[model samples]
Target: MNVPMLTTDFLDRGVELYDDVTGVIADDGTEYTYAEFGERVDRLSNALLDMGLEQGDKVALVSGNTHYFLETQFAVQQLGMVFVPINYRLIADEYEYILNDCDAKVVVADHAYADEIQPIRESVPADTFVGYGADRIEGDWHEYEDVLQSGAPESPERPDIAEDDDATINYTSGTTGDPKGVVRTHRTEHVHALILAHHMELVDDDTYLWTLPMFHCNGWGHTYAVTGLGATHVCQRAFDAADTFATIREHDVSYLCGAPTVINRLIEEYERNEPETTGDRPVRITTAGSPPPKAQIEQVEDQFGWKLIQIYGLTETAPLITTSNSNRRIAQTDRAADLKVRQGSATLSTQIRVVDEDGEDVPQDDETMGEVVVKGNQVMDRYLNKPEITHDAFNERVEGWFHTGDVATVDEDGMIQIKDRRKDIIITGGENVSSIEVEDTLYDHPDVQKAAVVGTPDDDLGEKVTAIVVEKDDADLTAAEIEQFARERMANYKIPRRIEFEDDLPETATGKVQKYEIREEYWEGESRRI
Candidate 1:
């Protein structure tokens, strides 16, 4: 048995076995074998070194899900450098904050995002700024292709790294304001990769399609795990429902991981028209950004015949901690409908608990609610430069638990059902109400497609309940009708005092309804983070 020490080991081992096979299929139809991928990473590593980039230095990669993004990832790890993947959607100041904070010595940007990088050029003091893709823009940056050609096509010596050595710094999307840097170690990455591979049932035969942005927790660590298992990667620069369907048919993608929103969009397209595929079809899709509705889950199975496994985790948790894998109990049950509701049990390497403020364990009696806590190798090392936050995140007095701000309950069968984020809980007239519960109830309605409940301002009550709804096409949904539906299912206090109908709800990059964004209007001038 061989123990893995480097993240780059995935490509090295993959190429040795599947050197000639198409390992990466780009959108432009460009294919790269494992051997070619390894060579590109080696050249990228050598190029960084030649540009005077030292080990442990920060290198920022700003792009979507592209082959170069994947190459830069392994290259940074090979040279013992920290790969800082910046959110391409982030505004100039946000990008500037990341660059200035990380002090990145090199910035590898996507050519499509040239406008975003142009204004911020003066802010980055890196030795090199390489732009990927075909075409040249007048700038001080070097072409991505030119850099690879300038350096030797060989990987530098692997870094003498300990298990605790920092590998990457993932900037988490903040619901309130500025993004926080979550530092992850190589051990955390390696362990999480193995955990994801096992939990998601990833094997050598699996062909993964990248639908989620790679900037997001390294696409929930699928980048390494897929390669580790010698799985082919169908890389897409950007996500489109049509393109996604076409790729699934073209490559016969066996597995993919994305947010619930991605699944919803695909399901919408699928319902409009059935897609025909000639090759291997996708068998599984792991979703985690937000818990998908049961209707969406059923649609995935009914339409594409794919097993939609729901997972839950954040960028801080190395992205894969708990999953809703279908078990024998579900397979044998008449209630496949009920099983989809629970986010399910923890993975083999993950230990999950629902604890109270006192840090004692909450009862496994489904009715009891508590804050969800986890302790695992997948947990992040710390929040970079935020010791206070890091300290709060990893508390030792409560039996050394990493406090996940999520509130949840565990059923008798040991299934963990997340209720809501601790901050998202609503308190009206001294009563604690779960917005998710209200949202769930609203989702049960026939006309409702998407629902987000937020605590709005109220002179009488401390905070009034408000629900924003998106009605299905051609479905007649009025505020009075929705109010009546909520009134029957929920307590009068939990019912929305105000209802607003929208064509679409504001969403995060991952498709999670930015409840915070919706709540912001109601919470104008308020000092609270909620």
Candidate 2:
């Protein structure tokens, strides 16, 4: 079958179809109609072309969620240039590596992050580095507003991009180590947007709130789907529980995507004061980054009455390979609480399998442990400048499956139960301990807010299990008390041997607890990345 040819074609469609109604609502009370936003995109594209940007050249965008980011994304694609969205949460050096690695030709950044780019001015050898703000800086740079004013509104010829042509390069947050460039194509992104829209039940009536950062998987394909569905959009400059609740009520937001940390914070805020500002009905929230505990899931549904949908993916999978669809069985039974734990099956355009160490398919006995492998149209084309590693990722001890490096078990009911990341499992005294299990048990404690478990160095036990915890502000809890809490909930060996408490844990911008950062503190003075 021939693959469909699709570019940033939806932008043109949206501009022609719904040019009158409200399209984007920014945090600073800036609102634009669909026609006005489309014209801005065209002007931005013309400005980029006037500066002599070439086709297929990489343009890096380092900023948070904003309307400008969306315009720049479409603008670059209009000129047939590839867009590289850098995670703003990365350190200066990591940011430098990505800019250098991808050989970005131009960089457009917001003024708030000017200090972030100042540290490594000479690191990225881009042709132009423009900052978006009121003040002007000296060098080969121009103000964002000035560029739009200087150039005439000209439509550059869109390249005849094949389905395999590169469209964007999104870097993983480097939770494990060095970030890898997950290259996505227009076709992949288009398909991913469709899958997310269909699986999440997003429709024209849905009003989307941009909660997730656009730099991450292109806001997990919401930027495309929301526009394609002609859904109203509400933007937040940053995450604030009160602000989010108010936005939901103000704009009547029907759908949003966030990490479990976002949900946990919102849930905590609701529990603290029972938000009176919210609408009569609960909003829908889609959460990923990590498998949330059943207790948290229950809290979200019971207290807030919000529909919590669980999804699973990496940057390489367009960040949406599977989603927990409320099936007929789950809807009929009273086991909605139990169903929330499973990550559920693959979405419409994805396929997944659980296999043993020898690459054979594992039986869905709900007890047999195996690695989860996937193959789908949404899988990334390749990792930029890392052909060897990309080839290894695809040929991960299997014939044709792309190795996820995640271990899981699928029950006969087709629900996937994630055991652990292949590297996260700890074998202590020949007994395998899923770090997720320990963390799940810790999450049951009322005083514990966020918990992460990792294996620390040990001479006798080979590996020791440790739990790093963050406590609720008003709740006073000690390490011994937490140990007792875990002892009552889990098996003897699975209990954490050591407990560490902190005001806050290190996290990626997407709110994933950087477990490697947690483990690094315990393994200091060692030469290993772990």
Candidate 3:
């Protein structure tokens, strides 16, 4: 008999084999074995279904990196309900849009985000609201622990969950308009977990750190992968170098993932603390977003004694299609650091190619730049409720291939290296910032005539969000003034860190601002373009 693929399979395998093994380590100072954790998941899953959450209902999760977030990930999907994890960094209005946009039936959040969610409850209300941990806001909500205990611990109603069932709707940043919800199925998420386990070599002995937010592509699907293998998950409430280092040592963390900006921060913290190095077992970290400069990679490895493995993908593709880790050729050679910064080859079973404007494969000389397109099992099904946009995304260039909107090249060894992004996106600290969003906010300033936003190379953030402008003839707008205007309109990370005012900006004949000219100086010594 052929068993259908489902994310719950991971948990099933863990309970069958590693029932006695520790499954999760929460920063809340609580630990649970596979058997206990599985019971809680069963109870929570039963609770939601018992509380009138029908199959296919959308449940919104709002929180940072915490254990409750991890538990909800498995619970909601047990009965085939769709889980929508919102980014905690978004403003109140953004949260309201996503909550209402997804038509969420339930809103589950931790007390840390009460200030943001408490106000939005009046505007976008869910059928049920649940809060966990201390300091929960005053609202119509039940405590998480109470709910978890209220449900039956035995197996809940199993709704014939299939691989093709609608699983998650991950909302990506909106550069032009409202954020688009990228819809993914169980098959996509299930395969992504397998790929992560295979490439990262996750085993029962590995203790994975929860440095990445569980909201980001379901923590890039590691929640399932690591838990399935019966490996211990060391969860964190926040990302601070001191706390992260303490957790790594405290839990004996073996692996983690983050952007280049995160690695930079860890490196800085490691130097200041001067902690005793990992003598026998070095921590392995996976870095993505803009590839870290080779020098930064070297610094992280040398200082912290952690192996840096780079991977690349977007939230649309179940978050991972390519990785730059464990290449035998690169590992055996002396130039591993240089090769590590390239996004490297496709992940297991993932097919990637660099093609020119006509969709033909670019030469493998690695000099010619082209758009990076890919076809894989893990690609998202489509954008939720946006059929036209989804059709346009795949109809471009190739018939079935998904356009990545990233410019890159393929080397003779078949390794793909990202050169730049075709879309006007600024990836600072691993977060995608739409340049158009920032530019629109800049234009809102009464004194601003023309504005352009671009990424500038920085030692920490990888790319610093920078804005260049052509001020109104008689108006004088300082960098601080522009930044203040932007902060009021957008998230803190989206605000321009550096702003420059000029009499006139270089523009094309059609009156479009040529951002490359403005961005050229800051990136002169850089190896990769945005």
Q: Which segments of model 1 are wrong by more than 4 Å?
A: 1-4, 134-138, 277-279, 396-399, 526-530
C-alpha local distance difference test of each model: 0.82, 0.83, 0.80
How many residue pairs clash in each candidate at the backbone level? 1, 0, 0
Between candidates 2 and 3, which one is better according to TM-score? 2
What shift in Å separates residue 252 of candidate 3 from its native position after superposition? 1.0
Clashing pairs in 1: 252-280
Q: Judged by TM-score relative to the true structure, which candidate is superior, 1 or 2?
A: 2
TM-score of 2: 0.96
Of the two candidates 2 and 3, the one with more favorable lDDT, higher being better, is 2
Tens-digit lDDT string for candidate 2 (309-380) = 888998988888887776685786686867777788888868899888888878989888889899999889
Q: For model 1, how does the per-residue alpha-carbon lDDT over 263-330 read when each residue is reduced to its tens digit?
A: 77786677667775225554788888766777777777766778878888889997777877867758
Residue 366's C-alpha lDDT in candidate 1?
88
| TM-score for each candidate, following the candidate numbering | 0.95, 0.96, 0.81
The lDDT, on a scale of 0 to 1, for candidate 1 is: 0.82
lDDT of 1 at 4: 47
Write model 3 residue lDDT over 312-384, tens digit each, in one string: 8888887788887865867576977778878888998899989988999999997787788889989999988
Task: Report the CA-based lDDT of candidate 3 relative to the real structure.
Answer: 0.80
